[model samples]
Target: MPVAAVALVAGAVGAGPVIAAVQGDPALPERTAEQLLADAVRAARSDPRPMSGTLMQTSSFGIPGLPQVSGAGGSSPGALLAGSHELKVWYGGADRIRLALPGRMSETDLVVDGDRVWLWESGTNTATRITAGREDLAGHGRAPGDRAAEALPTAATPQQIAREVLERADADTAISVTGDEKVAGRDAYQLTLAPKDEASLVREIRLALDGETLVPLRIQVYAEGSAEPAFEVGFTTVTFSPPAPENFAFTPPPGAKVQEKALADLVPGPVGGQEKGEELADGAEVVGEGWTAVAVLPFSEKDLRGLASQKGQGAGSADAGAAEAAVESLLKSAERVDGAWGGGRIVRTKLVSALLTDDGRLLVGAVTPERLVEVAGQK
Candidate 1:
């Protein structure tokens, strides 16, 4: 399986051991950072092993009032790194993956087998399924009603996050090996990447690579001008043996609802619901690249109304009014501003900045608010 495939499983279904092993100081052999990173890529490409582990996540920055607008919480990567959470995982290849999140009353699970995926809420005895080619039942990057997609646990896996940063490293990034550290009872190389661009909101990104397998053990992201990391994700306890096949199998209860959906329906819709740039973005413009990039999306009338309609639950319903009001409340935190791209509210956080136009469009990026506004005009 591709490394990216494993990442999808980790992000949506987190896991690791709950108990920490006795701490030990282990000295690691000297190796160039490039060698370590290359080994990581090799490990990802070489073999797909069955691994089970414990994991956790937390976050601080979110859109003040409008939760969705922040796009930081829920099954989002942001949420995976914010707050407190713990989970367990079992992975066996393309045909099988299992996640167990313990709750106060029961456990929630996501299981994948071959062409179908299942989400079971043990507490409610309910299950949802997404069959192959079932577009209507899925959404970009996740399945409907899947808590991992709707909201992430408080944690991420280093293999998932570090791989992405390594692949994107280039002239815009300053990469270096910063010695070694112990993670999950293993001595690992520490690789760090700092953005060369001053406009980038991120100050640095660090990854710990397992010395033997080359898989990443931990990943951390730091904000500009901050001494500490804003977010982190990693495994606590893990094993390399393959998990049992039965872990991926699922059967709904007698009274449970098993709605089946085609996978094709889950793709992201074209931006503005138009077909010109199906690949550009789901509904936004990507300006620049690497760490300095910005996304300018039109979030005006049609988009807002579409969101309102869903949350509203129907046409001419109180839910719609409530949704609209909620949106207004979220946008209220933005400061009023007028510019070449017209007027909109600007919202800033430690690592992200965005503009919400009076007319409804939004300009967002990790860079300065001025950079987003500049990109907005060009768009």
Candidate 2:
């Protein structure tokens, strides 16, 4: 699995959450949904005390053949353990984990002086250079999780709700206080913010605010077409001060397989040609349970880059070419069943990743070869 995950990082896009729906109850508020939302934002920002904490986040989903584990069968869990004093975050995914810390951004005496971001892998023996953005690691490097958490306090926060997606609220939003609940053992108020339309990516944001400071203990985001809960974040052992000086250095173990190229530079580009058979007519209907198969012909090639699931994954730098190959293999493997296309009944054929990328894309709505033939012959 680790091998596959490494392969996927070279090819797939990242992941995010499904926003919830915003059906406002009449008892919600008179200030309008957006207004109430603004109030909540103000309350969050008013929290002057900076905070640092460790966050353990987990998510899971069902897969075709793999036995169910956590969250759901196919879903996977991700975690971020961060400390404020050092401005570092330890990120853990299903197959891999890494630690990151502030660099040139802080006012410290360290001589390793931040010129580049650094990364180290346990499986590999060396540290690699990473691109630190212009503003990143400049003052007090902003951890990605920090940025995400900070955005939560701003009304400008973007979210997805069901079929609707709200980018930035332009005062047209409304907000109000609802009830209260216990979050991680803290007394909290329930605040709801609603967007104006059903299309709003965030239907309603239900928050559990700390009663005394109004710091959010938890937040619930609703979106369309997602049964899964909207994303949630929490902090523990949090401190608002700068982290220790020694926290930001990346010392790869001896003999690490250190690569000098930027991540993008190392990745291969597009492969696979658009042959007559390879190119599906525009609007041609192709369906499969495997996200990869559905990805190449019917969906844009770009989508293949972001593929993730429980099956095949993590085939490092070789993924793009591999994906093209996989597309061809899938196309040839598919048979027609009474006018419908189907692959074999391993459910969706388990993806065979040569190098392993992240989870290979799940092929959905696929049919078996015999079934496909039967269906195509009839029509």
Candidate 3:
């Protein structure tokens, strides 16, 4: 499993929740559905106070014969997602946060303070940093960078999840305050989003919000027709009280090699920026809506090169060409799949689906492979 995980990190490896209907009435929300969602947005935006917790990500899918993807040690691909992991996390709002995962030797940390972001790897006693607006991407920077699969999904906060869920409120989304429950040791309200789109593979998405704070406490994603959640993430232990100020500060360990670079240099010019009147052709357009919205990105040689570059730039290693070669070798071993719509390789998990098409495009979504493939051919 460890070896596979390591391979997944090398490959940058790659969901459903189906909830049963409530039998009887539970505690009703004092606030209306709109009011509750608005409150959640406010809580997340206003939460500058320090918070600490243990995060759990459980993945149980039916994806078969897939390769490992990227992430922290022991937190890669198959086993890491299918099994349970305890990640100790501290947040001091957007600019300051830390994630720690224990490994065989030392703990791995992805810490961001101010303009600098640092990634610490186990056993090597090394740290890598990237400053804002730089050209070369660091060990996976925050938003606007590295949106691919990582164990820590730096941007996947409760508030962000809530925002995405609520922003898509429209005809296709059915919003209801289903019930009330306890989350992070606090009374909370249950909100369910069920999809009305027949093309969508999603069954439902549920969020638990603190009754007082309105911050989302948990999010579960269920696929069509499945009672089990394909993806679930929530805090097992949490505290709203401000975390110690020291949690936001960090100093590279003595003798640790610290290399700094700009992410822009690593990104292809077209993806990194756009000219005055030029617009993206099929680049990163949002399809579907509400619970089934998918992000389809234009992928070609440049994107592949960027991924290969990211592989080589990992903190513990320094082998750009070899990393690119490794990626090539990995791709060679992938199971080639074709469908009526088109031909491509399906990299999937129970909760998530992504495909690299023969037409130089990548379609990704929480929906099933069929949905992604359908979108792939259309675009």
Instruction: List TM-score per model, in order.
Output: 0.75, 0.42, 0.68
Could you tell me the TM-score of candidate 2?
A: 0.42
lDDT of 1 by residue, 1-379 (tens): 0122222322221222222323355567777767766666667555456687876543344445433322223332223332445567787864566776765466677777755677676666667675554232333533332212222322335665665677777777777885457777776777888888888777887777776677777776667766555555667777777887887778897888677644433223321123323555556666787777776766764675577667566334764676677567656767777877688778776667778787667776677787877876776
Summarize candidate 2's per-residue lDDT along 1-379 as a digit string, tens digits: 1011111211111123322222333332234445445555666444234333443222221122222222211111111111111222322211111233222322111112245445443332345554434343221443332222221111111111210112233354555665435544444456655555332233454555555555554445443344443333333323335445455445655666766633233222211213324434444433332111222223332444345221135535453455455554544443322223322222222112111112222222222223333432332
> Candidate 3: minimum summed lDDT over ten consecutive residues — where?
1-10
- Name the top lDDT candidate: 1
- The candidate that wins on TM-score is 1
- Candidate 2's error at 67, in angstroms? 7.9
lDDT of 3 by residue, 1-379 (tens): 0011111211122323222223334555577776776666566556345678876655455444324432333632222533444467787765567777664456767776655666676457767665445332223233322311132433244555555566565677777774557666667788777777765666777888766666677777666777776555677677877667777677897888877644433233432354323433555676765555666778854577688787567533545666566557645644566877678776654445667778777776666677787777677
Pairwise TM-score winner, candidates 1 and 2: 1
* Models, CA RMSD each: 6.7, 13.4, 7.4
Arranged by TM-score, best first: 1, 3, 2
User: In model 1, where is the ten-residue run with the lowest total lDDT?
Assistant: 1-10
